[model samples]
Target: MALDSNENSDKSIHKFESMLKTDDVYFFDAEDFEDIIHHYLNNGKVSLGKKAIQFGLQQHPHSVELKLLHVEVLVFEDKFEEAGKWLDELQNIDSHNEEIYVQRANIQSKLDNHKKAVELLQQALELTDDSFDIHSLLGMEYLFMDDYEKAKLSFMRCVEFDDRDYASLYNVVYCFEFMEDYDGAIRYLNDYLERNPYCEVAWHQLGKMYFSKQMYQEALAAFDFAIISDDSFLGAYFEKGKVLEKLGKYREAIDCYETTIEIDDPTSHAFLRIGKCHEELGNDDLAKYYFYNTVHEDPLLDKGWLAITEFYFRKKQYKKALHYINKAINIDGENARYWKKCAEIYSALKNFDEADFAYKQTVDLGNFELDTWKNWVTVLQKTADFNTAEQVLLQAIEFYPEEAILYYQLTLVYLASDKPHEARKKLKSSMELNAEMVTHFKTDLMKYNRFSWITAIFADDKKASA
Candidate 1:
């Protein structure tokens, strides 16, 4: 009889404890709910946190914590105007609520009102007696402004108040890195590694810093540690592959790019790096295959076409280069740069008529480079359009008066028109300008290297005089 009575009493006690947990406390405990909401917000559970806060708001309709949390939730959702509206609500609820003003300041910061944010933070500093988060927030505002030195000071204060939080310490490492204070970054990162050996972001950052300083071996060590910290670390793989390439380990670099591609990232730049590695290994056919795949896979990538064109251009295959350049130009017909490239390849093949037309189109479509215009003149001379050719040469001279070769070319244009005296005068002027070309070459003044072209016109003089 006594054992049964004891069991029933224990069951009742358990039931009452469960009821108390489910029931709202008679005493207002807004801080407890605020802390819970903050935890969820930081952990990316905004929806669940919002729901919990809504329930708390209903329980305590006049609580400043509820309104502040609502504003924070709106900010997390990127509803800036809605956040401002709630911020206004918070200020109205109780103008004397110091926490409400600080929360409003946070919303203003999110709205990118830096001046107002600083003013509010300063005011909050006095009200909260220089609270650690307010100082951190000030530092964060400066950090967003890329003020690394001031950001470092803010993070330092954060650590002083709460030494256990890793985030502020992490900011210190980042600030040092951005400031180019590499020694300080390395020292702090090493110290942090003692407590957090698996901090992949810090390790990855250290590798990048050392890499920039050309400390290749040390960079490799840091990247390797970062990769080991997280096996699926794509950033670490990219860094490691870059270092490997610098070390002339092309094969290893190729493997790393392949692994990154296998991770199924559709927008992977790994294909680009992999193709370059194949090109370095003297497997141009394989390199071309990858480049073509990259182009077809991501049809909008200009880099893919550029890679394909460069491969053949490097191989001295002008026809193959022209084919790809034309294809690239077709995709973006108004792209003057591609048209210029097409014109260049045509010039290389001595297909001057086509090259001139392409260059004209390039200039028409907004290419204004001196080199492009000079290329135009060279193509025109090859095509025997001395009239058009002279105009282009004059444009070059007009822009660059010190070019003696341009004046020399102008003399050729006059001689082509059978005006010998005019040609001689211009030749003398060209020699005066350059001085080094006075006795250079006799036969260079002919159009397109076909010196015999002048004879057909001069033959008329021979008949008339006879």
Candidate 2:
């Protein structure tokens, strides 16, 4: 019906355009002018739409509809004040015209007056028998107000009016998901599927809901159904692979990911996931091949480079790991994970200076993990940079004030720096925080046993505890 209407409008539009070309006066009815103006406006030909409206108003001087179209064009051009005045005049001429109220709502929505927009849409809903568009608009207003329940209800009505309204269906699901009602989303999608059995989108969404809840078998079934409904559904194939991975079916997961590549162009994400699956299945050669493909497909993808770096690192190929990690850091120097990995690879290769620099970068990039601080301090100590090691431990203590290990490590730093007074103070603090950590301190203290004053302090603490 809509296509036929557009076709009919196209004929009127052609006639109107032909008349304009020949300086001929064409006589068209008010409805034909409306269709011609609407065709131009819908196709984004605003100047032509305005010309049609001018010609239309000339022919049908009392046409409320053409005047309303003029108001719509004004609103589209963001001439809200003029549009509002025209709407007011048109409403007085035709008090019950729903388009006036809808146009008012549109202007209000554009001005960020969502509440007023909702009230105006409510008025339009009362005046119109077909309320799908009004309901959709109300849903958007409710969403802007963060009223998920009302938004859900409005979009649900749209879905009920037209089950093929996938946009409204997605909005309904979004409302449910935002409210954290995963079970409700699953139930709603299941009910919708009962009425529309071949809805691949609903099936795919249902799969995601189940996946969020860790219902792997159900998610797998839903994704499989989505694929059955539409064999070339790339999203379903990709999600099915993720579910298979969670189920420890690596080979099957690889096949599902491979199917997505066959259905469409290969994405770097797919290549990366396939590489991970092959690695999990102990296929190093295939993993390496796909990992390379992943980076080649998208050099800017930090994950791909990190994956290749970690693969080599796990194999104890520190040189290869360092090489790839440098590339990853170059791609995303701000990424703490990349810097952390770079630090670890340098440490594995016993490059203390470079490792220390990478560790400092990792921390500066806001990675305050406990092991990050600990590893960074250890690198400084390895380089015999006692003063820097002391400063790093002091900073780590600020982050982990109650951590006994940090205090104990600080005590080690003090002893290394030949500060007996500071060393004893830190040792006491560590003992108070956690006395059991003293044993680990003792193992580290073996090198500093020449400091008899440190030995005396330990003996005094042990005696006091006894």
Candidate 3:
């Protein structure tokens, strides 16, 4: 309908221009001026609109519609004060006019006084015989205020007047999602589907709500319905693929994702998911192919790089994994997980210095995973960097105070450094935290020939308790 309207507007504009060119005086009525002015305004030709308004008033001096268009032009030009004065005059001239109230509300909305805008629009709603535009404006004002429920109601009212208001239908769904009312969204969308069974967006949104609740079969069916409504619905295909993957149907999921690529241009998300589905199906070569395609499609897609890196890691190809992970870090240097992966690969290759640096980057980037810290300490110990190991464990203990493992590692570091006093103190702390963890210290204590220290500490604790 919008396209048809635009086409008619273009034809009218061309006819009017032709008349002006052929005749010395191209006489037109107020309605002709309104159409020309509206065309120029909608097309963002403000100067043309202004010229039409001037010509319009000369032909029909008492045209309230022409006057309203002039005020709208003023508002569009950010001449809010001038527009307000015009609106006041219009209101006085026709006290029962709804357009005047609507224009006033638009100015108030622009001024960031949404409450005033809503009040004025509500007044217009009461006066106007047709409340469609009023309800739409009220919905927008409520949306600006983040009162999504009221906005939803207003938009629903607009929808009631015209079920073809696709924008309002979308907003109603958005409000339901924002409120986390999944059941409400399902009920609303079901009702919407009953009225407009061919609405692809409504079916897609219904599928999403079902997917969120882990109703995989229902989600799949909804997505199928959406695709039936619109065979070229790319989002429905993508979401349906996710549901298939969730249901452990990797091959079917890949087919759906591939269909999205065929329907539209390749998206990074679709490629990544296809790669993951292939990986799950144990088709490593295909997985690697899709993973490479994923990064090739979107160079900045961090997950694509991570997927390729994990592929190599799973295949025991540590060098390739390290290479891809380094590429990931270079692309997104602030990502802690990439740094942690780099640390892990370096540690696997026994490159302790590089491992230490990568671990430092991981911690600095706030990864703080127990494995990152534990392996960092292990690398330090492997490299005989006892002092740094002790320092790292101390920091780890602050974050993992309840974890007996960090304290146990600290105790071993102290003993390795010949700090018997610190060792005994740490060993006592670890035992208090978890007696089961004391077993880990036994093997290391025997290696250091400090079994007597462990026995003595326990005996001392027993004597104190007695």
- Per-residue lDDT for 188 in model 3? 94
Q: What is the alpha-carbon lDDT of model 3 when measured against the actual structure?
A: 0.87
lDDT of each: 0.75, 0.91, 0.87
Q: Model 3 over residues 1-466: C-alpha lDDT tens digits?
A: 0011255556667766776577555667787778888887777778877877887888888899999999888877789999989888888899898888888888899999999999999888879778887898899899999999999999999899998888888889888889989899999999989989988998999999999889989999999999999999999999999999999999999999999989888888898999999899988889989999999999888889989988888788999999999988888999888888888888888898999999999999888888888999999999999999999998998888999999889988998999999888988898899987676667677676545867764565569789
Q: What is candidate 1's lDDT per residue for 187-278, written digit by digit as tens?
A: 87677678678878778878987887889999999999998998788888888999998998989998877777776574425777778788
Stretches off by above 4 angstroms in model 3 are 1-7, 16-25, 40-62, 73-77, 313-319, 325-466
Give the number of the best model, judged by lDDT.
2
Query: Which scores better on lDDT, 1 or 3?
Result: 3
- TM-score-based ranking, best first? 2, 3, 1
Error of 2 at 125 (Å): 2.9
Question: Cα miss at 300, model 2 (Å)?
Answer: 3.6
Q: Pick the winner on TM-score between candidates 1 and 2.
A: 2
The TM-score leader among the candidates is: 2
Q: Model 3 compared with the native: what TM-score?
A: 0.73
Count of clashing pairs, candidate 1: 0
Span of 10 residues, lowest total lDDT, candidate 2: 1-10
